[model samples]
Target chain A: MNIERYDRQTILKEFGMEAQLKLQAAKVLVVGAGGLGVPVLTYLNAMGVGTLGIVDNDMVSLSNLHRQVLYSETDVNKSKVVTAAQKLKEQNSETDIISLETYLTPENALRIIADYDMVIDASDNFPTRYLVNDACVILNKPFVYGALHSFEGQVSVFNFEGGPTYRCLFPEMPKADEVPNCNENGVLGIVPGIIGNFQALEAVKMITGIGEVLNGKLLLFDGLFNSFQKIRFSLNPENSKIKALQDSYDFNCEVSVNSITSDDFLQLLAENEIQLIDVRTPKEFEKNSMSFAKNIPLSQLEERQDEIIFEVPVYLVCQSGVRSKKAVNKLKEARANAELINVDGGMNEILKHAIKY
Target chain B: MEILLFGIAKDIVGRSSFRFEEGDEVPKSVLELKQKLNNSFPDFGKLSSLAIAVNSEYAQDGKSLQRGDEIAVIPPVSGG
Candidate 1:
């Protein structure tokens, strides 16, 4: 092993040569190679975590450059795990890096996660997050959880040291569509960096047994206000009682990925059978909206929901796709018992297709 | 009272902090505070749960809010 490469951390009394060896023997899997995965890979590789597996199906895109720091302009259009693996291998010759250039599906999650001692959940989507959590629970491996939205980031460790699992903290999944993701709400670039650092620290602490790991607790960081709060939680026990892994459900249908193109949306409108629910604010609907659409702003949706006529399927539209997604989730939560799909691009799609302002 | 919003709560309210004037609706209990937030931003109800913290400690629904307590709304985050 290259002792000089890890001289800084090994010199500490808690993390001497013995701890270095422990890191050398550890294997960790990091899901998603986007904003959070960048920092996680950098730290674990630099710290000489023995065998690291990187799994990501996404390719480097121009939009990812802001937060996914590991990739450069030249690396765009290439496989993320491949590019990340090459860079990580160069950073530390003593550490072994494996690149799994595929998405973590239920078919592959168990097989891939079974080989690692610990898993770092850097996934940006809900379905994958739940999948990782459930898989970790069944496998009996502790996983570090990190999530960032807007200016806030949350960090926690699930199924570690007989502590609470993710399900214990979050029992039911949020109606897939209502959850506002960074793609639409927008994010401050540094937020994920801060949260990802916390995730990496948790992993190092867990492996070295040096400091307190977030067990049955969550650390919330708000970059805008510059405050940190730790929230404690008790295990639900029922959430942790997963006897077996279930079938993998597709995120698009189960969650909020149901999007119909402007042309198709207009075609459906012409049929006049389906109900059109405008989820935008009253001002937005007044400014521009379909002629047959009912203007039920998202904020006032529940109070005015009787207009929905639950027996029929509903199509939702907003300024952008985000609000419409939220409207679908709201309807689902109310158990309206009807199919709700968002207009693919919302008003943006209509404007693009020139279907009418 | 100023409620510090984090995660998706900020997105729903479109701000980092929400201030309540003396005359403005001052919710005495955590549940009332949440109901007030929901009245303002109906999307708040969409989240599975919003953990509240007062003076850096987790506050229960029945916990009373003081005049100048540090309150934070921790909404669930899924972004990486």
Candidate 2:
């Protein structure tokens, strides 16, 4: 590697040659090649962070071009990790870039994150964020957290050597619907640039051991006001609740139909006159049925248009809420006039309530 | 009490503002203060995940509150 390429960063007294070499030997994994990941990757790569791993399952959309600088208009439909790896390589061949062309799930997250010295949570969703935080906590790795919405951004270093985990600061995840995403609420392109760069700085600081690490503190940035605030955090012993999150997290976060009781269902049924549309298999429907309900097995619902006349509100019921939600979504796509609701408890909940066939 | 809004809350709520009220008693928990705000401005109930702070401190969900303290409601942020 040519030393002149990083003369600017090397000149800093704190980040001298020794620190640069540490950065060169560092293996960092950046999850998500979207808005925040773009700047974080670019800065780290430019500063000669040796081995970089980029993971993302999404391709470039037209809307993403405004903030995702690694991609161009021509790379619109290309995989983000692939395109980003290629561009980063072209800019600085000194850095070895690896691209994982798949989504990070609980099953594979531990292995993938375990290989890296540091992890950056640049993904957009809460489940993935929590997964990254938990995996890092379990493995005892340092993970940098950065998040941006509209003109504001938050950066924190969590799950590092007894430092605060995301769970310590926020023990519970929020309902998915409470927050509007970039698709619904537009973000200023520069907002991510500002945040991602700060994340990159944190990554470098963590690697080189220079400057005050965010550790248990959360840093807030406002692009609209050009202001920054740092809020301190402490490790909550109850955050140990995250220890059980290792393997069986699936059951821990699984959506059960049991969340809503039979009484709640009855109230909704009476108040909204909600009609149950069982989308279970015909054999399953024959085994049990709800009174005042229509049987439209999921397999035949698409072909049997006359079976469902969507004049009234429909509550979809299946073995679990998963298939019913899909059926409801399909019904909505079919331009049905009914408002869709998923009886989360499905047949199990119905059976528990002793609903007659 | 005064509250600060950051990230998603700052964006959606437009800007952090203040309200004038008088009370002798301090609240038992941050959730109670949150309820008071939600009742005062019903529109904010939609932002249930928004985290709150007391006097520039990261406020816990069920922690006690005091009078004349500064408070801020920050939503679950999604940036990086």
Candidate 3:
């Protein structure tokens, strides 16, 4: 490590030559290339964190340019990781940048994260977050979590040796609708910038072995009021109960949970009072069945709408409530008169509740 | 009774640590306490949809609160 390159940072009492060397030797994997990931990757690369892995499956959209400062107008429609990796490599050729142009599925999670010393959760979805946390816990690696919504941001370190885990803070995940993403609810541009900067600081701190890391505490920040607070939580023993989560099983489980419950909606079908529409794949319908439902999957719902009579309430059922709700919302939006009722518990929950039905 | 506070509620109350009566409930309904605290202190009125947890466990809507509970009035949680 050349002393001149980090002269400004080296002179600081806390971060000296040894800290720079630690940063140079550190290998970090950032899980997203949007919003928070941009600033985090930038600062980490600028500080010379030796090898950086950027993971993302999305392409830059016009809307992404607002907070994803890494991409330019010309880079729209380009793979996020590719563009991000290129830009970051240009910042400092000495810092090696590798891009994974795909989503972080559970199958590849451990493999991708195994090589990195520390991981950062900058992804935007619950499944990804849970997957990342579980993978981190299993790997026994410290993961710095950062998320921004509206004007608020949260930062925490999960599975840090004996520290509290994400499950300790939130034992069970909420319904997807309980929290909306930035694309749906919107967020301040600077919110991620601030949160991402904090993530970079935490990463640097973790690497250099300086400062009190956010081990067992969760830090929340409010941009509107400029306030900060730290809440402490203890590790939950039950987190270990989720011993192993395979890719297929987890994906199916998530989809099933999101699906409408059969018990709640099947009663209507058992009495022949309402019409049930199976908006799932033919294979899904073959595997599961409602008492009296038509096999018009969502792919064909639009063209085959005439096949089902409009005399009764059309109860929509899919693998999860997501597609069914979307179908109902779309039907309502199109001014369709058939009564639209979306079963809350999708097919998976429904079957669990009403196995005989 | 002394109950330590954290998150946005601490800032609203003006101090991170404070004392209050245990009240009637073992874990008092956060809504009722929020109203009383706002009426008495008047500043916490702006905090709404804030989650309440006692001793680090999320509290039920009408549960009674006890003394020494680590009361945290969390702003909308945005953690990943």
Candidate 4:
């Protein structure tokens, strides 16, 4: 170990050489390599965490550059885990950075998480959040949790020293369309940085026993108002009694919508005169869109239902595939017989093929 | 009673905070508060995993509310 590299932190009265050694011996796993994961991994590695693991199957896209500052413009379209691991290793050579280019699914979550001393739930979806909570509970591992929505962000430490778990606060996962994610609802670029830094601080505290960990407390930050609030919660004994993982954490089970890949949609467009609706905002539509696609943003779909032809198969698309699925659900409520097919991967995937508008 | 809204609740109500004035029919419990919000904004009922905090402490559905209590409605946010 390079003893002089960490002189500043170890020199502190509260955090002595003992704490530095603890950080060096810890093995932390960060679940996402996006906005929140960047700060958590960066700070933890810079602080000399001995072993770090990154899990993410997503590739860096142009949209992610706003908040996921770790990746550069040149790094776009590259694997996030691979890119992050390479940069993190450059920041600190002594730290062992393990990159797993895969999404956290029910089949592999337990196996991947069992090897780490603690986990950082930096994933960007509800299914992965619940899966991390259940897997940590089942394996008796502690994890630091962080999430964001628009201008507000949340941070908490779950399953740490008998503290409250994420399930103890929000017992059930929200339905697929109940709440909008960062992809649908915009988030300030700095919000994730602030929330992720909080997560890293809590993780350092938990590992080094330097200060009071955010055990059983959820910290909410509203950047619009520049205010912070902490909600104290207690553990539900039943939550810790989770003996096994659920068969599936997917909340989209209720509504079944047919989906076609972007490539297949392109093929169909060439062969037939198909009806396609771009469900993104007007600004997004103006930026780039298929010439055949009609603009009917998801927010205004209700009032513009008459503009769509229900007799034919109507395809829905957005920046990503999420909002299009929501549009399908909304359209189904109004016209149950309408055949709505969501374009999987949306424009992001279509752009990959370099097809002309 | 003053109610604070976070995440989707804030968007549903179209504001950060609101007050249930003395002359209004205020909710007496967490469950009633949620019902009141759901009655006003139907979207509130769609969120299956909403949490309520009273005076910075997590409250159960049956927990009684007082006129001066500070209540916050927090919905799950799935962004990183």
In terms of lDDT, the poorest run of 10 residues in model 3 chain A is: A249-258
Candidate 2 residue lDDT tens string, A116-186: 99998998867688888888877888889988777788888987767888877767666444565564356
Point out the higher-scoring one by lDDT: 2 or 4.
4
Predicted candidate 4 versus true structure: per-residue lDDT over A146-263, tens digit per residue: 9999999999999998988999999988876788888778889999999999999998998999889889999999999999999999999999999999888766656777899988
| lDDT string, candidate 3, A29-95, tens digits | 9998889899999999998899999998777766678888889999976778988888987888899
Report how far residue A186 has shifted in candidate 4, in Å.
1.4
lDDT of 3: 0.73
Model 3 chain B: lowest-lDDT 10 consecutive positions: B71-80
Each model's RMSD to truth, in Å?
Answer: 7.4, 11.5, 11.6, 2.5
lDDT of 2 at A134: 83
Quality of candidate 4's docking, in CAPRI categories?
Answer: high
Error of 4 at A301 (Å): 2.9
Q: What is the TM-score of chain B in candidate 1?
A: 0.91
Model 2, CA-based lDDT: 0.76
What CAPRI grade goes to candidate 1? acceptable
* Model 4 agreement with the true structure over B20-66: per-residue lDDT tens digits: 99898889999999899999999998988899999999999999999
Q: Which stretches of candidate 2 lie over 4 Å from their true place?
A: A244-357, B8-14, B21-29, B42-50, B61-67
Model 3: TM-score, first chain: 0.73
Q: Which candidate leads in TM-score?
A: 4
Using lDDT as the measure, which candidate wins? 4
Lowest lDDT sum, 10 consecutive residues, model 4 chain A, at A348-357
Q: Give the range where candidate 1 chain A is weakest over 10 consecutive residues by summed lDDT.
A: A248-257
What docking tier does model 2 reach? medium
